[model samples]
Target: MPTLETLLLQLNSIKVIDDTIPYSQYIPLDLSISNLDLSQIDIKNPNDFEIYIETYLKKNNAKVAFGGYNEVRNLYKQSSLFGDGQVNERNIHIGMDLWIKAGTPVLAAIDGIVYGFDYNAGKGNYGPTIILKHNLENHFFYTLYGHLSIESIENIEIGSFFKKGQQLATLGDSTVNGGYSPHLHFQIIKNIEDHFSDYPGVCNQKDLKYYLKNCPDPDLLLKIK
Candidate 1:
């Protein structure tokens, strides 16, 4: 299994986001917009909003964007979004999102093998997701990359080897990704429990302690800030 330090070293080398530029340098608009606040821009439909976000990412020359804690909170409350009445207090977010235009490259954070993949189609869902299993030193864990294009899993074989920082997939748009702005939903798992291609990205406040322990802060590896 790998130690946290070893995983950090691998993720640091991956081009998950633009290191030369800060998110503020790329997205001048209030980060709040990425959340659930829809009043700032005129969005008659979901696709319209998705396109707007995708365009913004491209203009900023950002290969990937991060930061949206507040927005994700709002997404949970939206009935039209997750459709789960009243935020699943037990299902608050457990991952940090990396916003980038669809088709933007996604790389493995560590050397791992394909664990599973799935197409969870719906608003506030992880569409075309992939999970990789890694064993470092004596620690075994998993990494999940969600909201990916369908092409990402078209021919991927289970147990396939993936080198650290290898191009795993590309970001998917709202049409394919869950009905929201385009982004990569990355999460770390200590025990997958036979699950594949999908894991809880959110948890209720009551389970916060458990989820936090199971899913360590991804920034520990990504170090985006």
Candidate 2:
């Protein structure tokens, strides 16, 4: 049997956002703690973060700024959901983020059925989220699409089917998207382990190894440059 990573690599042309925008227009963005440029902006404020993202896109002449898989960031410090400044603070991001404007079409990475959906509702939360269960070559796994508009889940059923590249949801803004700049938090889970509509998109250093193994780099599936 092929490994999940191997199965993902065999696939092609997978996208989680607007199909019209080619990969050429998707530029890499570094939101890690090491990015010195972040020190100049207030990441806690959604408006400031949005402005920063807009400037980044404009300067790079790109439509999307994508990255953040396995990145250690300080952006979560403002939200207690990640934990206080004490032990076990979840500061490392385990999912890929595609920074784009709110209301952008969010598409399914592959054909799958909705496993769960929820309005995570809170600061630093995923907001409206969806999880899809997929079976490829008899290898069952799941994909999580987070930070979506409320309407995206309002009319959807738990077992609804979505085809690859189909529009599954629209991106939500700061007001309803856990108070962060608009973006899609995409993750691949091999063993969902009782997780429902949402999964941990960030982890602490102690659990990094486990998450890193369970959630392979999304780029393997995306192949976005």
Candidate 3:
């Protein structure tokens, strides 16, 4: 069996934010969500969120601001406005969250077939989600893309094939995405246990060890740093 590091090296790269331009040239020095206009909360509309994210990246001079384990954890802890108080205790955050504005395009990290999808509606939950199954050198694994707009999975079918970097979906707003700030929660799973459209993006402290083994950090493949 291939090790996690080996598998990550084999998979195609997926940037949390756009990487078409040079990081230093496109990134900003002081980027943050608070500085943006919150009145226009519905970033799902065509091109709205994309512009917002681009602006933020330019402001902070950051090529990728979110979608890493440490990045999301810090955002959650600092905001103090998202999630239940049971964040660390609930083993919350089983994935990496891309904190771009809503409606940012989500791409497949590797070539794979659609395994499942669903709308897990609730507070601090993944409103619309999709899971893709990939096989690398005979080793099979799964990737979950959560907090997507309902339109993303409205007609997606099981077993559909997606090439690496293929646009799978777009980010959703807080109301559409479990009532929180906009972001994409991407996770890698070794075993799915018959789940579809939704899986435990967060775990209980008691099962931390089990989940940690089952769902390794997405950064192993993303390599954001």
Candidate 4:
């Protein structure tokens, strides 16, 4: 079987964020152990996190930031929804996050129909979410767009077709986007299975092996680097 990464490598281009944002202006962010910036924010305060994000973009003179597939993040530590009892806290993220200003236009990476959508309201949740079903090459897979505004999913249907680079949704603010900074959490899934509207974008270390395969490195297709 050709792995998700192998299939993604065959694609020439895929853009989840608006194509209008130039590649040169993209600042790749790191929230792992190597980053000094992640330490500046108080995980409990959304405004504090947002301020750091805004400052980082301004300092670098960049419009948007990208990266974070399989990247371990400390942002979810404050939420019990991620860490409770038997579940060993899911901190390892499995998506390519495109961090930019709120209300930024989000685009479809490829031509696909809306598979499902929902308002996952809660702290550390995806907020307004949408999943698109696509048949790329011979593989039937799905793409998830997270942290979108409520309006984004207001008029969407189960089978609404969207063209590549088409304006699909707009990013949401901290009030709706799980109390973090504004950004689009874009992820690719090999098998959506029984999940719809909401899926695990972050996983615990014990479950990393399954998620890493279930959700391949989106950068393989985004090729932002």
- Per-residue CA lDDT of candidate 1, range 64-180, in tens? 556543233545543344445554553367877876667778888879999898898876678899999988766888999999999998999899999887889888877888766
- Using lDDT as the yardstick, the better of models 1 and 4 is 4
Better of 2 and 4 by TM-score: 2
What TM-score would you give candidate 2 relative to the actual structure?
0.99
TM-score of each: 0.78, 0.99, 0.74, 0.94
lDDT digits (tens) for residues 51-158 of candidate 2: 999999999999999999999999999899999867799999999999999999999999999999999999999999999999999989999999999999999999
Clashes of each: 13, 0, 10, 0
Best by lDDT: 2
- Which stretches of model 4 miss by more than 4 angstroms? 85-87
- Model 4 lDDT tens row, 1-225: 776578789888667887887778889888775676677668568888778777888999998888888888787877877887355988899999988888999988888999999999989999999999888767899999999998999999999999988989999999998887899999999888899888999999999999998998888888888
Clashing pairs in 3: 27-61, 27-62, 28-58, 28-59, 28-60, 28-61, 29-59, 29-60, 117-197, 118-197
TM-score (C-alpha, index-matched) for candidate 3: 0.74
RMSD of 1: 4.0
Regions more than 4 Å wrong, model 3: 16-59, 67-88
Which residue pairs show backbone clashes in model 4? Answer: none
Residue 154 error for model 4, in Å?
Answer: 0.7
TM-score of 1: 0.78
Hey, what RMSD does candidate 2 come out at?
A: 0.7
TM-score of 4: 0.94
Could you tell me which 10 consecutive residues in candidate 1 have the lowest summed lDDT?
26-35
